[model samples]
Target: MTKLMKAVVVPAVKAAWEVRQRPVPEPGPGEVLVRVHACGICGTDLWMAHGVLSFREFPLLMGHEGVGEVVALGAGVTERKIGDRVGLPMMQKRCGACGFCREEHPDSFVTAGNCAGPTLTGVNVDGALAEYAVAGVGGTVLLPNGISYEDAAPTVCAGYTTWAGIRRADARPGARVAVVGLGGIGHFAIQFARAAGYHVIAVTRPGKHELARELGAADVVTDGAVLKEIGGADVVLHTSSSHAAAIDAMTGLRPWGKLVLMGLSEDEMILPALSLTTHSHQIIGSAHNGLEYLAEALDIVARGQVRPMIELFPLERADEAYRKVADGEVRFKAVITL
Candidate 1:
């Protein structure tokens, strides 16, 4: 017999969310059924709801950052079992046949390299806004025993994305990392860089210095003055959604330094030719987490090296939660709890 569950559904772009009863999804081969405890409200959710990013399927279920306990397992799934806590991040599933999934060594990083096809949970298909959600076994990670569902929810996407940027920068001990923007992603970036032994320099609009410092940032600066004080930074994790802010961050990077853009923007950045050619600076764009990266993030949270700050909203108040995130009123991240 098919089981039914209540889920938040959007009939169309710019439509009001409605609570609808949908048939509980059964796990297919290589997948697992998760009884969702919490799901996060992200900027991407807003973009999808507002029709900014065109993955435009109507009557959609949206939520990529989800944490839950496994309730059932599909055939051939030996990695996890019922009652295990798991996380479903945005990069939900990848084809093992792709170059990104095939590597010569296990230590090599997994990334969405040049491959065009991948299954995204919220954007491409149904996601975790429901009482039950499905995730690929390979893409799911077991949450740390110490982290609660509310804290673990945002880490699936918001936390992993920033951690990926910091890992790409390869910041060494004492190297300076200037984190631009102090939103959800930036908050985690600051802590992850610090945990990686980098001296974090947080940059945000004028009033966010204290908040940045509270997140374990070694120093806080409102603008590019951080460049002048330290002579330059070894790496810059640019998480600001503004195009101008993303481009300006390049000025703070020392010669051969890395600038990782973790923000979503549609604007074009006009870079000076001499600036790139002379300094040998690198600009890297990142999204979605690899299996190893997600596991590493969970481990970091487990060890108390970093923690995500989140506001909880009841599942039925998903609309209010989305509005709060859209209005920039959420302190850090917002989670829909069951």
Candidate 2:
């Protein structure tokens, strides 16, 4: 008998989300079957649902940041075993023959943003918005023992992205680091930078001041000009989706400072040529740099050095959770508990 499991399914672009029964997917070669315990809803998932990012097909199962347990293994799989805890990331598979993959450093594939052939879970393929999902063995990361499924879900993407941005900045100890945007990613950036022994400053709207402080930000500013008024930052992590905000935040960079961009903006970012050239400023774009970074993010959370603020919803209330996330009503990240 084919086993059936509950799944959140989008019938078409801009269609109403449905919680329907789907057959438990079997792991293929080099794949493992995961019984999803928690899945984090991301802005990218919203984009795909709203057709902002046109997927090749509809009726999609969308969720990239998912943590669960391995229940079954497919042929030729030795690295993972049943009952092992794991998390599935967005970058599920990469073409090893591509130039980006051939780079000397694994992080280069992320910096280049072009992996010739890539299989993005929850984007181009079926994802973990279901009771059970399948993932390639190479794409799954072992979840540390201390962190819960809900907390570890966001770490795979949100936490990983911001941590990668911080690593890309490569700030010195005691250096001032300003994080622009107080959303899911920005919030994580503040904690990660603070844990790394940097002076963390948060740049966000007036509403998030208290939360920012609670998250270990030394100072919270409304914008880049305010950030500049105080001592400028040696590294600026841009995690907002507004290109204008990124351009504004550049003014807060100290001489020879690094500005790392982790946000996805539809608008083209325009920088002042004179300012950039004269200051010798370096602008970097970062994403999930490597699986090692994901592991590190999880480790920090497991050690209690960082915590991800999240709102939880049962799988049955998946639609309500989606609505809250789309309307920006959730305080921070939203996780669907199974």
Candidate 3:
């Protein structure tokens, strides 16, 4: 008989989450079976739950920011071994024959929107909101030691995306880096920017100023125009799910500065051509970017340079956790612990 494990599943679109028993999946070729210790609930998971994302497969098992130890390895898998701690990010597998994958440009797979490959974890296929999950070897990252499963779980997606945004900014030393939306991703942006030697400025709504400062933000402001009055930002990392917020944050970017957008908004964002060209500003869209970036993000967290603030929920209370995440009640990130 196949082993059974408890998993959080959605039977239909916008349905309430149910913790049900699912057969533990076996690892296929070039894959590893991870006994999941923790998984973070991301905005993408919430979007998928509501059928906001393009993929609409039913009975969704939604979780991408997962971390655990490799319990078994499939045939031809040598890079990962049993007992190795690892993280499963959003992009599980890409078509190796595609131009993006052929060139090892994982970033393009997301930005160019041309990936002809397996669907994303938690988006189309069953994900890690369970006792076990399988991940392609190429898409998994070995988690560094010294970081708990809870802390490392959020780094798989939230930390990785924010770190990629910071890298996309490529700001000079001591530059003013402003982070928009002090949520899960934005909080990591502030810490990573500070670690990268940039002066961090957090742009967020009221009541979050103190939290921003606590996360290494040198300054905190309620509006983007306030940043302009404070000499402008050399780089702005936009992590809000609101395109309007991104537009407002762009106002704070100095001439020749770059604005890195790592958020997803349902509505379209309008950019003024004249203002964009006149300012000589560049807009970069970043996602998980690469496994290398994920490794770096985990390493940073492991080294104590960055810390993840997460609320933990047991497997039985997964529904409550999902509700809190959907309701925006999680202070930073919510991680389900097995």
Which candidate achieves the best lDDT against the true structure? 2
Error of 1 at 96 (Å): 5.4
Residue pairs of candidate 1 with colliding backbone atoms: none
Off by over 4 Å in 3: 98-112
lDDT (C-alpha) at residue 132 in model 3: 95
Error of 2 at 305 (Å): 1.3
Which residue segments of model 1 deviate by more than 4 Å?
Answer: 95-117
lDDT of 2 by residue, 1-338 (tens): 25999999999877778999998999999999999999999999989998898756888999999989999999999999889999999888777777777774453336335777777778777899899989889779999989999999999899999888888788888999999999989989999999999999999999889999999999999887888999889999988888888789888888999889898888988888898999999989788888888999999999999999999999999989999998889978999999
Give the winner by lDDT: 1 or 2: 2
Candidate 1 weakest ten by summed lDDT: 104-113
Worst 10 residues of 3 by lDDT: 105-114
Among residues 3 or more apart in sequence or in different chains, the pairs in candidate 2 whose N, CA or C atoms overlap within 3 Å are: none
Over 127-177, each residue of candidate 1 has an lDDT whose tens digit, in order, gives: 999899988897678997888888889988888888877777776778988
RMSD of each: 2.5, 1.8, 1.8
RMSD, model 2, all Cα superposed?
Answer: 1.8
Better of 1 and 2 by TM-score: 2
Off by over 4 Å in 2: 97-113
Instruction: Find the candidate with the highest TM-score and give its number.
Output: 2
lDDT of 3 by residue, 1-338 (tens): 25999999988877888999989999899999999999999988887788777575688888889889999999999999999999988787766777666776644237236666755666667789999998888767888889999999999989998897787677788999998998888889889999999999999997999999999999898887898988889888888878888788778889998888887778799985776899998988778666777888889999999998899999899889989988889989999999
How much is 181 displaced in model 1, in angstroms? 0.4
